[model samples]
Target: MLKLVVNNDLHVNKKDTITCKNSCDLFDEITGECSINQGVDIDSPYEAARCGFFIHRDSMSVPEIKDHTHFKFSLMDDIDDDLLDDQEIFHQLVGKSIYKEEYTYPLKPDFSSYRDDAKWFVSPCGSYGCWIVNHYKKPLSIPKSKDVAERGWNNRVYKSPIPLHDHQSALPISSKMAWLIDEDGFGQYALLVNGKISSISAPKPINWKRH
Candidate 1:
């Protein structure tokens, strides 16, 4: 059965749970009045993704590296926890990434054929950037322990270089499943299938060992 390949130590079994916030929750759909860079101070899923949250360069499918017209770069924070009624301005100020397609790294792995369901592998962890690799013998430090918790931001950075051994044949699971990795301290990664834990079909640990 195709499954999400996560760290072996993550406590995500029948007893576990998960919650996925809507992409809009990160930043609402911007109309003519509000910009996409709005920020909410009361602790929201969108805070970390301010400024360029509206436009996306990376996608669950093959990336569109050249479609960067607005740039979507972060500028400054505009607090929205106070402006409950104001819709004219965004919670933050931002611009686009100055670099173009050439500067950006390869979104796909250097391989031959890609899988028909490559997008499905990224569906669960699309919100937070996820990189699939061929090998990781060293135990995952971030989300695994506090010693390297401070370096959690490096998840996308560190794994980025190690491209997936098989770009197309990623382990697939139903979109009904939602995943969350608590890197700050909980030291747990969860998967909620069909909005609840009861939906998991014989939850089991994934094989992340290098082939």
Candidate 2:
């Protein structure tokens, strides 16, 4: 079953509350007001990401528009319950929500090989430096909740859902793609380049929109 929690200006439930020190410019510190026109309800982390909400790093709660507390959480009866079983869905949500810089063409087209060429593309992981993907490294811990709306980011490379493929990730092509690689490295929903898989990484944070 899908679970939901609603929050508003008058009452903020601990389960649905989102807090950050300097996250949103739209929030009014004195009045506790959120100036955005966020909808009353968001059903999934995927949907929340599309709306530019982000998972707070410290709280590990469902991402929300800070100060835009008038929100209602509900399950979409039409969504397949089986799809919710995939923990990869949470990983996708984190990848989608975080802001990252992307390049259409290879950063260095003259690299000796596709593997070397792929390394030129970098993820501006917030204030951190380049995200290093090591094939031999273990995946970082992330929220294991099956509830899509409750998932949060864990400040690490998003692990691939498929076993033995932890270093790679998949995200939807939001705006562009310009080169082809001969490697299959992404999960489903990734934009294929010449029938090969591409790596995915989370970007920096995005601010909530103001009305």
Candidate 3:
């Protein structure tokens, strides 16, 4: 429903990969290597947008690092199975896994609405779900396949599962969703105190030590 611009402002593209060139400085967010030696077409800007926006939590509550919870975030179908029946390119939770070895928090706090502000969301496969926000910010990583040892950022699991309210859209939040805006306007991560995001950066790196 949200129209996010995939501003690859740098116009960054490796041999065949469109990567997060901007964020790599924070860490190598882009792949150092590619599956094919030749270049791959960047997901169409429209497709990219539908494939969803790279959700960056501009604000959130503190997480209870000590607690470990089982979140059903990986299964796109269970989240909206009817939509996934065609199985275009959406992820399937049936064979996927959740990341816990590092204790990531993708499942909690789908949004950081202080009271009701919501962020525009698209499933990695492009499904849109109802707005949500919990009291705190917990980074839970959703993984494909239940292999505990394989739970890490790499290995095609970095994309968090998108939650659709209904109707199956596996590669983009269909335009249909935006038209159904509920009373709340559903989402807007930009908190307007005077109309701007709070602009706070992570104070420090946290090691949850979650077993």
TM-score: which candidate is best?
Answer: 3
lDDT of 1: 0.24
Query: Candidate 2's error at 177, in angstroms?
Result: 14
User: What's model 1's TM-score?
Assistant: 0.17
Runs with alpha carbons beyond 4 Å of true place in candidate 1? 1-50, 56-146, 149-211
Error of 1 at 175 (Å): 7.4
lDDT per residue (tens digit) for residues 1-211 in model 1 = 8999777876645222211123322222322111212223312334434422223222211112222121121222343455424321121111111222231113332221122312223322232212221223344433332333432232321222221212121112112122222212212121121122211111222432222
Per-candidate TM vs. native? 0.17, 0.18, 0.19
Model 3 lDDT per residue over 29-138, tens place:
23331111113223333322222222212212211122112211121122454644634212111211112233212223222222343444444543233233322243
lDDT of 2 by residue, 173-193 (tens): 222121221122211122212
Off by over 4 Å in 2: 1-17, 21-52, 55-77, 90-211
Q: What is the C-alpha RMSD of each candidate to the true structure, in Å?
A: 20.4, 19.3, 20.6
Backbone clashes in model 2, listed as residue pairs = 99-203, 99-204, 100-203
TM-score of 3: 0.19
Which is better, 2 or 3, measured by lDDT? 2
Which of the two, 2 or 3, has more TM-score? 3
Steric clash count of candidate 1: 10
